[model samples]
Target: MTASHILLVDDDVELTELLADYLTTEGLEISVANSAEQALALLAPPARFDLAVFDIMMPGMSGLELLQQVRPSNPIPVIMLTGKGGDIDRILGLEMGADDYLSKPCNPRELLARIRAVLRRMQTPPSAPDTRVIQHWGLALQLAKRTLLFRDTPLELTSAEFNVITQFMQNPGVVLSKAKLTERVLHRELTAYDRAIDVHVSRVRQKLSKVLPEQELIKTVRGEGYLFIGEE
Candidate 1:
């Protein structure tokens, strides 16, 4: 299993250190940052931060601010750490794209639970049901293998990108809205600010273009979502 690299951002010295030690022991690679500016600066180079754990009360720039600025460009998952009894902050944190929220007096085990849950949802298996296949152009989809093939040549796809393509190919020419795509791929309800699906769609299109450059396989519908274009 691939270990997740988590960015720990907080202004509290003792708490950050303690959390870092505990999370590191749990087989996660951790990078610590004291504030949002520092965290954003660290996120610039290398670009290997898989997730971020942010404290909502940091000085200079708040955790929510950091997310607002970066969420437009970065797709890194985030879990916000809020002060205990601050329900309003917690609600706002989630609204602002925080994947999950942890309270200050949170139990180590509880935080671990939320972390694993979020990661699990993000990494859910895409084992397609047996006895199903969708063919477009000269491309074939192996439902079991979760692989796309053009003339039996396998195509590499990112997890999210693969999920979206799988859904579209399974029901070719079916117009799937953002909500439907999100539910299928992310396994969650769609929010207006949900751009994750769009990112995955862009990536899937790129891969398809590389293999099927002669035509646009996935057609975009005006005022709608997308469709896999091919004769039934």
Candidate 2:
């Protein structure tokens, strides 16, 4: 089995070295990039990475800007490292298509756990031998390919967004609470005031709305949660 390769981007040299050593000791391949520009270079061809850990605050091009640039062409799952109490940065990272996030000055063990969780969600189960397509309304979700289509036109979705919509489509008309979604999609328990699940759902809704104007496929049930309105 090939080890997962991670690109760690941060301006703190000592911190990056510490994480790289710790993650490497845990049987994962690590690549260190001290700046967003360096990270972009490493992200280019011939340097495939399973996941990327980027610090939200960086010199020159910020992590958010780097994410915006990378997301359009690359679907590599990203986990942002934000400063403690940096709620806005965390939310912005998710809106820009990040899979998960961690607060900087964090415990290496926690970061490792989050990394494993995100990678696990991105993996396809070997038990499913054939492609399974779930069609609802005009949307088609190809489980094997992990692609979503609207009226046969492909709808781009990040790894997190893909999982978010999959849960909704599979359980149409079912109200999935934030706690359930966080566990299912992110493979972690929901923390108080954590809005990662909400941001992911919002992104999916925004994408769906572009192709599904005048149709509200996913509905919010006020205090309950979100419900996917399937064809009755």
Candidate 3:
């Protein structure tokens, strides 16, 4: 199998180097950029990268800014590297289309796990020999293409949002606990107060609501989890 290429962007040269070395040892190909500008240049057309790890406190063009600019045209999965206590930055990064976030000075092992999780959510599965689309209650999921359409209108969703909605579509009315959702959608166990899954589900709901304004599609089961009210 081909190695997954990663773009690591941060102003901290030493950290990027250490991470590159560690990630390489862990079976992922790493590319380093010391600034958001350099990272943008590397993202130019025909230069492929499976995922990006951006530092939110970069010298110029913060990771949030980079995401705001890139999300309009590029759909690459991004994971933000944030300093502890920057809750605002983490939330804004997700709103701007980041796939995940990791606190700075994090264990290399944890970062590796987060990266693998994001890749699992972003990577499209192989086309089934028998079927490629799953449809229920006016929502059509093009599994092979990883796109969702409602009433023939396509929904613009980030990779993470698409994965969350796909899980909902697959289960229909099944009530999925937050822990179960986190494990299924993020490919990791849920941590205390970890709101990543909730944020992604909210984004999906917002997009779905915009297209289907008459009714609520994903309902929160207070104190339990989320339920997708769709026909099986």
Candidate 1 lDDT tens digits, 1-232: 7788888898888877888889889998888999899998999956777778888888899988898887746767787787766667766665555665667766777666666656765653557446556688887888766678889898866445567788988888789998888777666667654455665677778778987788788888877898888765
| Candidate 1: residue 225 Cα off by (Å) | 26
Model 2 has an lDDT value of 0.92
Task: Locate the minimum summed-lDDT window of 10 residues in model 1.
Answer: 123-132
Ordering by TM-score: 2, 3, 1
Give the best candidate by lDDT: 2
User: Compared with the true structure, what per-residue lDDT tens digits does model 2 show for residues 1-232?
Assistant: 9999999999999999999999999999999999999999999997799999999899999999999999878989999999889999999999988999988798999999999999999888779544778888899999888889998899989888889999999999899998999999999999988889999999999999898888999999998889999888
RMSD of each: 8.1, 1.2, 1.8
lDDT (Cα, tens digit) per residue for candidate 3, span 50-164: 9999999987788888888788698888999999888888888888889888888888899999999889867656655325688876788987777898888888888878879
Cα error, candidate 1, residue 144 (Å): 11
Name the 10 consecutive residues with the lowest summed lDDT in model 3: 123-132
TM-score of each: 0.56, 0.96, 0.93
**Candidates ranked by lDDT:** 2, 3, 1
